[model samples]
Target: MSSELPAFSWPTDPSLQPAIAPVPTERITPEWAWGGSTGLGMKVCIVDSGVDGDHRAIGGMLRGGAVVEETDDGVEVTEGTHSDLFGHGTACAGIIHSIAPDAEIYSARVLGKNLKGYGSTFVAGLQWALDNGMNVINVSMSTSKQDFAGILREVADQAYFSNRIIVAAANNTAVYSYPWLFSSVISVACHAEPDPFTFYYNPDPPVEFTAPGVDVDMAWAGGKRATGTGNSFAAPHIAGIIALILAKHPTLTPFQIKSVMYYTAKNVRTELAAAEEEKRDE
Candidate 1:
């Protein structure tokens, strides 16, 4: 006997339309965005060399992680706890942890001990993060290869539509890079500022934000600490802040979160001065 499949149908007229709750404030401020948020329930994935769970800076906040390896059958992602091949991933994790200590951090180690890896491996790691229900993905490294551009764009678009935010770092040099160049991701670069919480949103295209990256102290592998500077470090600062926002407003989509960031950005806050004044008058 043949069995009938369940019917799949769209909502009828009486069905309520999908909608997000309106933000209570007319003007988005830092206080309104993530003032007291501790990033309690957010899941952040760092796609990099790897993350050292034992690092002091991590503070035992790592939930789990995966390692992407190259085998005869192509790329393989093994899920479990992993160590940072290089210190890059640990540094990124430290930044995010410092900003959002309560958020769960997971690592997708794609790079090798040399701090480099194949583009295909990077893609696989990113795909792993997307499939594993990561709320935010920190991509401090990017591939400049033209062959991977199409796939990277596709993945970035998927993250955008899936309510998963990908905070990418722009290349430190003048060279080009994938994913970060896409509008679907939040691209960040290094600023000379020392304050981690002080970030600026650029009005230009591609690079949308700037965060502290110069001489920033970070958690290194082997239970040590180090200072470094690069766009790589900058991306996690934004990623951490994004975690805070997601923690407070769990229902918000990626685009809505970006709008909130734009409004609360250090540079953009001046434009909201008039709005704040108007609100005070009421």
Candidate 2:
């Protein structure tokens, strides 16, 4: 005679049901995620050198911006319009504009002409973005200094909790960096793939996604266009996608938006295809 086993109650049981229903995989397709979305009514901040609002590639999407400069007292964040000190910020803004043309772009100029700035200025720029109601902040720069890591992590966590999406670039070289290394922000790196829309999700930690960044042709300062390659460019591609996603679904939090990205990622698509094939065979 066999002994009767106790029933195992699943979480799906009515008495133990979760407050929120799980999203169906089929509903997380690209068409459902960002189709027909032009990023209208979304505010995206580019925290970099600066943004040239006059750039042809930007198409007058630049709304307003701020400049963060280190001073004797402390970091001074000046609010208003600013110009791109280097072409880097324009390149990032162009990538995002190309993908999400209608999204309002704001520049938080932290770096000067040398493409370098004090980590304090960088933190100030990011803080300004969060305090000013930016929906998505594209941070193509990171500080390798451990001195700023603690403060940077705090800002990153604040963004995560506030439903703000921060898309940060992984360091181009094998070096330690803050913000990007933090789990709170969406970290991106370059994939050799040239298609701007084609991105892959990595199961690995730290770097969660890869986008087209190799030899990417983007807008430059002085109203010119140029080709550049770096993880910096990759961050904007993901930021652009986030803008589009938010435009379509404005209420999605940072966590839910990341889930949407994971579900729509190329690797996930491959898995979906294999599952469909297996089902057909069965």
Candidate 3:
């Protein structure tokens, strides 16, 4: 004599597809932007694979900073090229520069040559970025689990204390990812033409905002042009947007700026999702 129990399944309706909002045209729409342009002399730090400081798209954007980390000998790991050997970081930096042409980008090499590294390195990079007075920090990488939330809160707290903002790439999977999942941080989702030929896709929820990710044309290492995927490519878009927001609303707190983005985002997904739902119901 067992009791019946109900089962649960994730939303399957096509209408539930993550909708993507179109990139903003105003260069600044979040009321925060009333303060100024994205770059406007603000400094942003990108903690990921190193960036190629010589890339054309990054001409004036690269900050040309050095990485300082503790080594086996207790000395700082400071020797290495600033070049983004894997091309991932350089691409992220390019997107940031495009939106905030005046913002300077500083890269902290944490992922190493393979574009992979330890959580310790990521933390170390954050410390470096903060110590360097970065106005915004873009973290494009994540760990295997959603455990980085606390660390993100701590970092965001420190940045907040210093009047800086920390933006991160939302995980690519359907599940949650760290730093991005941390409510204290601004989590940016990837958005672009699903098919290279298509214009764009509907926006996704739980995602605070969207940026160019799919088929996104950008700069690469060795002065090359390339296209690729990943939330890594999307984080910088928010970073740049935040910079512009700060430039305009110099008095707005990082938290307040984030709020403005949510309310001001051009929600192209809402209607798209409704139409898809009607079709499904029919």
| Winning candidate number (TM-score) | 2
Query: After TM-score superposition, what is the CA distance of residue 212 in candidate 3 from its true location, in Å?
Result: 1.9
lDDT of 2 at 33: 94
The lDDT of each candidate is 0.92, 0.94, 0.71
Tens digits of lDDT, candidate 1, 122-231: 99999999999999999999999999999999999999999999999999999889889999999999899998889998987779999999999999988889999999
- Report the C-alpha lDDT of model 3 over 1-282, residue by residue, as the tens digit: 745435754456669655644434334344434344546868888888888888888866686665544478642546445678688888888888877888888988877667777666677788788888888899888775445556756876787767788887878887666667665667777776442111122245556666667777888878899978777787787788778777766666776666566545556334545776999999
Best by the lDDT measure: 2
lDDT-based ranking: 2, 1, 3
lDDT of 2 by residue, 11-48 (tens): 54677664665668788999999999999999999999
Q: Candidate 1: which pairs clash?
A: none
Superposed Cα deviation of residue 171, candidate 3 (Å): 1.5
Decide which is better by lDDT, 1 or 3: 1
The residue-level lDDT of candidate 1 at 103 comes to 97
